[model samples]
Target: MDPLNNMLTILDAEMGAPSRIEKTGSWAVRFDEYQQFRIGAVLRGDIWLRVDGGAPRRLSEGDCYLLGDGKPHVIGSDLTAPASDGDAETAETGGLETARSAAADPAAISSVVLTGSLGLDQATEPLLRSRIPGYVEMKSSSYRSQVARPILELLSRENAWEIPDADLMRLHLSRILLIQLVRTALRTADGCAAAPPDRLLTRMDERIRCALDLIHRQPSKRWTVANLAAAAHMSRSVFAARFRTAVGMPPLEYLEMWRIRSAAAVLQSTDRTVSSVAAQFGYSADSTFSRAFKRVTGRAPKQYRQLAA
Candidate 1:
């Protein structure tokens, strides 16, 4: 049983099934509250996004933006343009302030922005942050041609009630979008190099994936670096070096993080006591688990459970 493998499995399970399509306005449609990752795809016409004192960025047709945290932001034709003074007072129709006051009405707009909100957690935020610029415009390009266009078309036709498979489709599309964005970011980060060309780092990714799979599959097992390295088919020294390069952390540190995260979910979602939860993740004692949990989360397990509950 590997703790890292357990963590990944939990991530997969805890990531909620994406919710119903929400019509926000003439210009915006969002996913249900269950989603932590939100994506807004623009179709037909343009939309503007105003983020907390930042200049508004206009999104044209076939353009998309991902909001990692689903924070309250303004999206409309003119994010900078002020609304009618009259509509400014009503809470719902009160203009820019009101846009964040409640979810936008999707039926009110013609051009659409597809929003896929996935509840903003650490695992998911990196995927969104690495790709989206403060504002990036995708012009006529093969990437956009192959990906964004199809997603926009599907979003345009599918109604919340008419489409039974909408949620699954959205999830799949989001995954595709994330992968494409990651590839693009990696390319840029690597200066357009065709490959990372670092054999050690490449091997490290494979090893980390193996380690991650082990932890996700069986979190209850007491895991160690020696065991994890063997799983990667490398000696500890080589495996550790490669894992650090690929994942930016040592294997044991990654395992600890995985354990703490797993314990957190159980603590939050179940009535299991701290001791039981700690033991579930292979902690020999509650005190040790508490210390580790506090170090990672800035709160003891008991405190976290209370707050989460």
Candidate 2:
């Protein structure tokens, strides 16, 4: 599998069903900092989006954005407009919620935005945080528009009609949209970067990906920074520096995290004893394994298993 797909699988990311946000006249909504990844598309009219006190940018019809930084942001017809809490304007419509301007006039509705979140687990949050920018904008004029436009159109159509399995269809389409957006973002310049892209993981460096794939595919294997660098065809010092810059952590540290996290999953799901599970993931001693597990999970194997059971 590709690196992004592999990381998604490990993270157990779930793309939630989409919601429609309709607004009229001068309206702005503030979305507080959130933990789950967020995606939004302007399906009609134009809106302004600002993240974490950053300058607002205009998003025309068909434009979309993905949020990875978990920072507070605002979206509206006008950035200078008085804002309302996004949560307060939410109302259920046909099993899905719709957000509207504080003083909404249905007849004068000017903007329709499609938004959703991708739920992920703690184990792989760092992988996303380190690789993806806090915010990314995919413009309608960009090369990715060919893929994004049709998907957004379909989502808009699905939201409007009452069809068979409509909820399921929207859910699936939203997932595809998010996946495509991330895939494109990895290949293109990250919008959040101040200068021309100079980061390692933001642009999907193939060499770094190769080293990451090896560690992810075989976390149980004994790994060292030097070996990982060698696999990536770089000298030890260069590889270590690059790996840290790309992943926000050293190679061996990442391997340990993956190993402990994978072992935690096994401990929770299977009947295997602590030592066997530890050994399966390359832990040589029960005491050592227990210490590592505790450090990561705040609980030892037996305690964790019992709680899970």
* Tens-digit lDDT string for candidate 2 (124-224): 66667666677777887766655766675576567667897766676566566666666656653554333322232446567887898897777777888
**Each model's lDDT:** 0.53, 0.73
Please state the error at residue 198 of candidate 2 in Å.
13
Candidate 1: list runs displaced more than 4 Å.
Answer: 1-44, 47-63, 67-204
Q: Per-residue CA lDDT of candidate 1, range 1-309, in tens?
A: 432223233342111222222223333321222224444556556767665556667777667655543345566664444433211222222111222213554555445444433332343233234323433334334464358556544543442335667555654554455544434433433333543422212333667667767766666787888998898898999888876665556777767776887788788789978888898888988889999888877899888877665
Candidate number achieving the greatest TM-score relative to the actual structure? 2
- Please estimate how well model 2 matches the true structure, expressed as its whole-model Cα lDDT: 0.73
> Which candidate should be chosen as best, given lDDT against the real structure?
2
**Counted clashes in each candidate structure:** 32, 0
